[model samples]
Target chain A: MMELFFKPKSVAVIGASKNPKKDGNIIVNNIINSDFRGEIYPVNPAADEVLGKKAYASLDDIPGEVDLVVIIIPAQMCVQAMEDCARKGVKAVIIESMGFTETGAAGKKIQDRIEAIASKAGIRVMGPNCTGIVSRDIATTFFPIKDVPRGNVVMIGQSGLLAAGMASDIVVNQSLDIHKICSIGNKCDVNENDLLEYFGNDEQTKVIAMYLESIADGGNFVKIARKVTPKKPVILLNGGRSEAGAMAAMSHTGSIASNARIVDAAIRQTGCIRADDFTELKDFAKVFSTQPLPSGNGVAVVTAAGSVGVVVSDLCAEHGLALPRFGAQTIDALKGLFPDFMPPSNPVDLWFAIEKLGMTRALEAALGAPLRDPAVDAAIVLLAGFEYTMNAVEEKVVQRIAKECGKPVIICTLVGYNRLRNRIVEELGRDLPVFTSLISGVKALSKLCEYGIRRHRFGDR
Target chain B: MVEFRPTEIHGLPGFRRRFIRTFSGIPYIDVLSHADNPAMPDSGSENFKIADPPCIENEPMPLNEIVARARRENRTVLTEIESKQILAQAGIDCTETRLARTRAEAVSVSAAFGYPVVLKISSKDITHKSDAGGVKVNLKDAAEVEAAYDGITQSALQRFPRAQIEGISVQPMARPGIEIIMGMTRDRNFGPVLMFGLGGVLVEVLQDVAFGIVPLERSDAAEMIDEIRGKKLLDGYRGQDSVDRSRLENMLLKLSAFVDANPEIAEIDMNPVFARSDGATVVDARIILRELSEAESARPVQS
Candidate 1:
């Protein structure tokens, strides 16, 4: 059912226009620019051709069968378009129009009529106000996105910000390795549960990050999440979790149990990792999709300065991560890298080592030894954004050692030159998870360790 | 010691009267038999039946009947006795409580259950018993029980003039221990959820509670117990005896099971449950029933 939306063979743009600024034009252009090999038909009464594709006056005029339809018509005309799609025997439709339930009662009535029509025709509607889907194979969003990398992470959102704003940013900046982004606004027919179940079974999808203002069906969500979480990680960011949000939920659902507390209970019960903000949602996905899961919550903090290491240790403890003592062999191995006056410890301070052997060799011994220790399940390498750190970033010293150790490693770089910092973020961060702050780095690593420990305790399903 | 047998009455076949021996080293029967009562009735046994002490061997009353009876009477709130009966049926332990319609019944029931005992107003209309002066605890003798019963009835009537007084409920005083609370409430999205926390100031002021969704696995229950900020207090603070944590977890699991089995229950509150080293006992309980819609009432029951 979901494949009809993502991998449709042939598609029709209901309101495709010749004007370059219109959403109708952008939708057609995005599809044409994507890797999609399917046929495209533009249904417009005014234009004879859209982006050089033959235009049809209506569904009846199209000669070939339409697998999916992307509707950009007025909200008032959505019901008529849905009726036309039903007559054409099209099973999937993405209505990217505005003025649905989010407006008021009058808009709600029109949405209800469309919902009735879709249900009767056995059709699945994606949205009444949204930017439908963005992926390497197809892009239906109004935003201009191209060359989407075939990455492993799949994002399911209930708002257009994910597909339009975030998708363009991530693709242009190459910040995240994203496979697909879906925005199901108003959720007239399709919802988060449908996409969760679909992506849960998707072989290419390794991590799922979701942002929802309200759950469509919480009971079904819990049931499906319990089954999917043991197999893969589901990171969620709930939009309306405040007391004011509870009031809005009361008007939406006409019930009292819509508070943040109950939603949190369901998340914990299903073992889904809860993200406090949008940054955590995306950052957690970046780390989980790239790094290996640790077997325990034990972490080793490796830093050049003692102050930053102390802060990292405190943040790790606050996140339920333990900084275990290094074993004798690992300690002995690290001692050889340190100078005579300085002794190696859990944080494995590398100031003297860096001063003696430079950044590349010091990190190779100091960071590599603890990562190889049996007591440490993960490592947090704190790097300063100075000219000295350029050698390590260029040599990929952290990346090489992290790969060899086979343990999860995150780098937090602060107090650095902007040029040097951007260089690290663009270079090392592309492969390994790198954060500008210690809290975010430690927090992301903690989520990985937590999930890993849970999986280790309860055998993988 | 007296051995009592089940007495066959006109229609009540399982009628029986059992003597309760006081663990507090006080003789209740002699005091009740000698106490003077001007308003006492000659035949107390005919009007009230002493509820049996809660034990594993006792046959649990049907839960649906308790819920249906409350709904039939146009009441959403179940009396404390009814709530305890429902909890006990779910395999959770609760202090035995019985309804006494008159002063004489209250005395005899308290005597049978032994002293010191607690008397609470059992009316559906009265929810805050202590606020309405409808509660009196630690009554050690018939003289104190008689005085406490009069004080409770008069105060409740003065407070809630039109309330329907269903007589006071008498139960043996539970020994002091760690105060724990466990409950279930229906969520609009997530069906039902269970909560566990320390009872007194921790829950009231700090709101130190952890919740788990219904139909919880054993691991979920264990996690809820371990998630609270005051969880370390459960392991014995200072010289106080630590509570039996496994027993508390079992009670939470049973609560989840009960909520899962009974969908009509809207909310349940078991507050100030006494948690001892050996076991935990629910000191007070309240269960609220969901108002059935017309379509829900018309649906056929599943076997």
Candidate 2:
């Protein structure tokens, strides 16, 4: 059923326009830009052409049968567009327009009318107001033209901006080869469960991230999420936490927002990692996608900065994440790498080593040094490519330490070198996810540790 | 071994007979669970400020006034919904409820919300209306509800003799939540001592209770909730989600606060506050309102 969306043979951009600023422009541009191999039609009569393709006056005029219709026309005209698409026998109409149900009584009336029309026609409409779906298999992105994502992590969300933002940050900023990003705005018809089920079966998609304002059709999402999370981590971020936000959520997505406390209980009961913010959603999505699930919660922080290290320690301790007491054999292994008097601690600070013995020993101590402590189940190394840390040996040392440590070793650096950052992910491979920000890196590690704790208490399931 | 001076019960000949007669069960067997007239110490600590220990404590009022008050509120017994509403003002969680002004409306509502919904005549006047046939349970459909409502109304009139018949209560038969009981009645000796216990059917039968003073914190409330043997269920044993314990703990704290705030309340009983996978919601509640007199006004309740 989901293959129809990803592998549609022909698609019609019903409200497709040449205006670069219009929502239709982005949808058309996204398709033109992607590697999607499908017949595309620009259906607008005002101009005989759109994006160099001959424009059809209406769905009735389109030369080929349209499997999907992307509509961004006015609300009054939307019902007509649906009728025309139905007459033309379009199987789906992706409405990228807003101003219905969400806008109170008048909007609800308009939306009810549209629902009736679509139901009569038997057309599976994605939304009356939504960002059309975007994917590697499809060139259709309803996001503002610029924010296209490419990665193995597929994010399905209620808020268009949230999905668009995730796509922008993951693809453009992180430079990840995201497999697909679907902005399921408003979720008038398709919801988290549908997309999650689709992602669960999608071979290309290795990880799933979702933002939900509410879950419709009961607890099916929870059951499916529980089943799929162990296969590949399903990172969840739920909005409507506050009372006012919850009430607003009902209008935002036709759901009761059904008492946030219940949502919280249900989510925890299902065993998905709950993300606190979008950064963690993306960060954890990437990390869990590539890294092996750690077997324990004990973590070792190796950093050049004392303030950052101590704060990380406090965060870990508060969250029940242990900074394990070092093992003797591990300490003995670390002694040779460290300067005199700087034997070994869980943090195993590298500031002193770099000051005296130089960058090579410091880098070795920073990366190669952390794994030596057997107490450390996982290691988080904080590095800022400053003058002392700029030596060419740092990346090489990190590479070796990560290779030796069977557990995850996440590299946290503020600076980005396209080649260096890309090289770390390539060399380290699935063992770790090198992050751009300290906050995200720390959060990912916390979730990894949380996953370990949950696994220990509840087994693999 | 260091020991204190012996008391009279300890030294008297046939001390066993006296102890058995004082604290024992039906045949006067010296059993702890059967303790009726509690050894005075069990009532409370010397410094613990309570009006009295758990007993039939009510303000002195003529039967006429009690009936009048019950009639004024249009109830047979102090109705469960009315009693709970009073508690909700002080931050208590009760089932979402609506009052029906007509019997037809009540019957229809009961049917819509599904069977097994609790139905009772609500009144601020009568205290034990359930005993007076003013309460009914688990009605299947509209006809049964209409019959039950009429039955309860007639019974209230027969028993109260003066209750001003208010509209009947049509409530969704309470969903199951972890059951806990909380109450406070003004005591003769100490003051208002709070009561906590194993709620539901166990409350009436087992009589398992733990008492504490008002205004409990999370720790104190948690301890009070766990004072009974059946509390192990809340700890998540044998493949069940942990009972909504955090909410249950809050209910305890709120109960203490409500009793402490309302000076007119002579007694308050919120029994079987059922908690489930979601949270604890109050199922049934009863409260006794005190009448103020100039003579009694010589001393207002403890500030």
Candidate 3:
């Protein structure tokens, strides 16, 4: 049933327009641009053709069976369109029209009417005010998203614009390897549980990031998450965590478990990682999708400056990560790279080494040695984007060592020229997870290590 | 004042079989209808005779009967005695509490349990016993017990005139130990969630509590115990003896099991469970039932 939405063979766009500026036009254009090799039928009584495709008067006018329908019409007219879809035996529908429940009482009544129709017909509805889905296989969102990478990460959100905006940013910047981004607004029928369960069993999905204003069914969410998280990491960013936000959630969904503590408990019990903000949501997914899970929580901080290493050490401790002492061989190897005055330790400060042996050699001995150490499960390598560091980025030294050691590594870049930093982000960021702040990098690595240790304890490969 | 006939027990739906199995030898199975007692009958001379100490080992508690009676009567709140009975049946330890219907019965019950007993007015209507001056703790002798009983009855009658006063619940004074609170509450979305925390100031002022969704695994129980901010206090703070952590974990697991088995229960509160070095004992308990919908009433109960 879920596959029909993501991999639909034929699709019909209700209220699809020929005008370039309209959402109906964008929806049709997005599907036309993507890898979706399905039949497209644009339903607009006023137009004979839409986006070079023949437009139909209604869903009944379409020739073949419609597997999926993307409705972008007015809110009041949605009941009629839904009835038409139900009569057409359309199993999947994404209602991108706004002015439903989120508006007021009259809107809620209309939504309820649409829900009754969908339920009676045994048809699944995604949203009443949402941008549907963006993936390599199909792009149903009104946002101009194209060339979506078939990455292993899947993002599920409740806000329509945020999910579409983030998808645009990620795709345009090529920051995170994303498989699909699903925005379920005013979740009338298809909820996080349905999508989560579907993606949990998906062979291609490795990490799932979710942003929910309210959970439709928490009991089922915990049950499914308990099973899915043990196999793959599920990162969650709860929107209504504060008192004010909880009040907002009540008005948004008509009901919510307003207690933040219980929500936190559910997250910890299911082993799903909790992300505090949007950046962590994206950053954690980036790290989990690209890097290998560490065997333990032991992290060796490899930094050019001592102060940054100290700050990272504190952050690591705060995030339940340990900065353990280096092993004898690792310490001995790092000592040879350091000057006489500075003794090598867990942080493995690399300013002297970088000045003496240049960027590549310093990283090879300083970052590479600890990464291969038996005592350290992961490493946080801090880099300052400078002219000298440009060589290492070009050589892919950090990326090479992280891949070779078969352990997780996160790089934090700070205090550098914009051009050099942009170069670093563009060059090394494509293959490795890079953060502008130490806390984000450390936090991401900590989540990966936490999941890794849990997996290792459960004897999962 | 209502004379309950033994033959009426046979009329209860699904109660005849279990009632016969549990109370076969016991004479005079007084079956009080919901009209007589809104919540449950008084402890001394009522249905399901109160064991002297109230801790009857291996005695199969009639959970279905109590729940059905409450639902039949349209009562949402279960009396404290009823709550303890349900908890005890789940294999969790609680202080032995028995009902005394009269002054003489209260004195005798306290004497049998030993001196320094606690007497609390056992009525479903009086949720705040202390506020209503219905609680008299640490009575040293029969004379004090007699006086306390009269005072409680008068004060409760004066406070809540229409309350269906069941009787006085008498239990031995539990030894001083670490005060812990553990219970379950139904979330709007999540079915039932269990909570663990320190009692008194730690919980009241600081609000330091940890929660877990129902059907918790043993590992989840351990994590919830360790998640609280005052978790270190559980490990023998100052000169106090370290609480039996495994025992606390077991109680939590048992509660999770009980909540999982019984979906009709809407909420439960077991506050001030004394966690001693040897074990933990629930001193007070409250269980609220979800209003019986047509679907829930028609569904077969899981034993």
Candidate 4:
């Protein structure tokens, strides 16, 4: 019954138009451009063809087996079109049109009619006010707004724009893999819980990120998020906090924000790491998708600047991540590299040695000391300038470090001609946490630490 | 005592928003502005004690004047602000409440509070009336709704008292939500410090409650909450709900704060202090601020 989305033999675009700028045309084009391994049929009243695809007068006129009927049309015509999909026995309908439910009284009535029609017909409606779903395997992006990324990061967001923004950032800014990005807008029918349930068993999905404006059903989300987060890291960027949050939730997704504290408490309890910003979402995804989850929060920061260590330790203290004092042995190991007065600590500054011993031993000492210490659970190596050469030793050291201790390592550096940031992700493949900024790197590691602790306590993934 | 006549705003001498924005705006004269109902209980409420050490050295120049002066200086201490000042002086820590009776009061109260305070009217008319104009908090008060206090207090007295009257209250409230009603009810339920959560307004909202025999301790207070039907929300559930029990325990501490502050508080009727990360404050407090006899003051602590 649900075969249309994943194994659809053919799909019909309900509001297909000849105009290139039409939302329906864009959806059709995105599917075609996505190399979707399925047949596409455009349903238009007057046109015989649309975007070089065989156009039918309507869903009933399509004749061929229409597995899924996706609509992007005006509000009034939607009910009749969905009724046609119901009549034609289309298993799934992705309504990418706006104006239903979101616009007040009139739209609410239209939305009610649509919900009733979809429910009775036993057909699932993705949304009445949504941008639809996007997948690398089959992209159904309406508006064709931005580039869809290629990798192993699956996402679900209530806002279509925010989801697209995330996808664009991941594709352009970082080297992280993108698997699936689903925008269940308005969520009239399908919501976060459904996606969580789906992604819970999704083998291909290594890490999943979500931006929930609000949860439609708190219980269902809690159940699904709990089950999924432990298995694989599910990073989230949830908004609608304040009355203590939960005010914006009404307009954004028609979700009750619950109490913001309750939401945070619930999400954190489920063993899911809630990202503070978009950068961490991709950063954590890039790191966790490839790197091993750190066993503990005890992190070591090895940077050329003392300020960097301060920044790292401050984050550690706040996030419940530990940055314990380095042992005499760990400090002594760095004594030769640093000035006499600058005694070594958890955030061991190597400004003294980088000029003398150069990258080889500085990088070695940075990775080696933290990896061996029983107290230092993880490492965040900060290197400035275009330092690809640093990665050579960093990678070699991390290889042994990861094997002996299951601690994650991150690198925050200024990427130059060598594209130092890019090379690290490619080499590690989620073997270590790598971020471009100090804040992001620390946050990602902190989240990994949080997930590690919460999962252990909850007795799940 | 009866000589303190109520002050009235004649003809709504409208305050110029533009004047507030202007640099040369001299506020020595009364710049007219509309007012509103309160979000919380009155500052002069029985529980909102003058915790600050008495202005023995510095004259207590009628705090309304001090508050008014502070408003011009952009550093006024409103009733709730002064309450906190009083509490700070007395070393009696209560839930942090921010007041906003008028723009000056709210600004003065907010200046004292960083973030997250019970935003309410400090009114005399309706003491227990939170739903009315007499009380409103958790609101971002920069929007300036002063008339709300009078509106609520008036609404309350008209609905309940009818003939009697009182002004408003704006308190920097705390959420000593793990409440055990420390007073005798006007109803048949008399004198037991009747702990309620599973039944009262809080339990209806938060869904956790209990009943203690009397003289609630941190433990007894904790135990009373065990009587709640929605104990799950209080107790840690599956990524669901959490109650900062320490905060609930602090309500007992606040009971201690009140009991410790004065010999009065013969019957404390503080219904709600919406629970947050921090401890509780008396949002809708109504203590019979009775003058104590020497013998009663000399009585041993109720431990």
Whose TM-score is greatest here?
1
> In what order do the candidates fall by lDDT, top score first?
3, 1, 2, 4
Candidate 1 docking classification? incorrect
Q: What is the C-alpha RMSD of each candidate to the true structure, in Å?
A: 7.9, 18.9, 6.7, 17.5
Q: Please identify which of the two predictions, 1 or 2, would achieve the higher lDDT against the true structure.
A: 1
DockQ values for all predictions?
0.22, 0.03, 0.25, 0.02
Candidate 2 TM-score over all chains jointly: 0.60
TM-score of chain A of each: 0.96, 0.85, 0.96, 0.85
Among these predictions, the greatest DockQ belongs to 3
Clashes of each: 1, 27, 0, 69
lDDT of 2 by residue, A283-345 (tens): 787677656567777888887777888888887776667888777776776676566866677
Model 3 RMSD in angstroms: 6.7
Q: TM-score of candidate 4 restricted to chain B?
A: 0.49
Model 1 chain B lDDT-worst window of ten: B19-28
lDDT of each: 0.82, 0.63, 0.83, 0.58
lDDT digits (tens) for residues A321-373 of candidate 1: 99999899997998887777777788878888888899999898888889988
Q: Least accurate stretch of 10 residues (summed lDDT) in model 4 chain A?
A: A248-257
Please state the error at residue A103 of candidate 2 in Å.
Answer: 2.7
- C-alpha lDDT of candidate 2 relative to the true structure: 0.63
Candidate 3 has a DockQ of: 0.25
Q: Please, what's the RMSD in Å of model 4?
A: 17.5
* Model 3 chain A poorest ten-residue lDDT run: A247-256
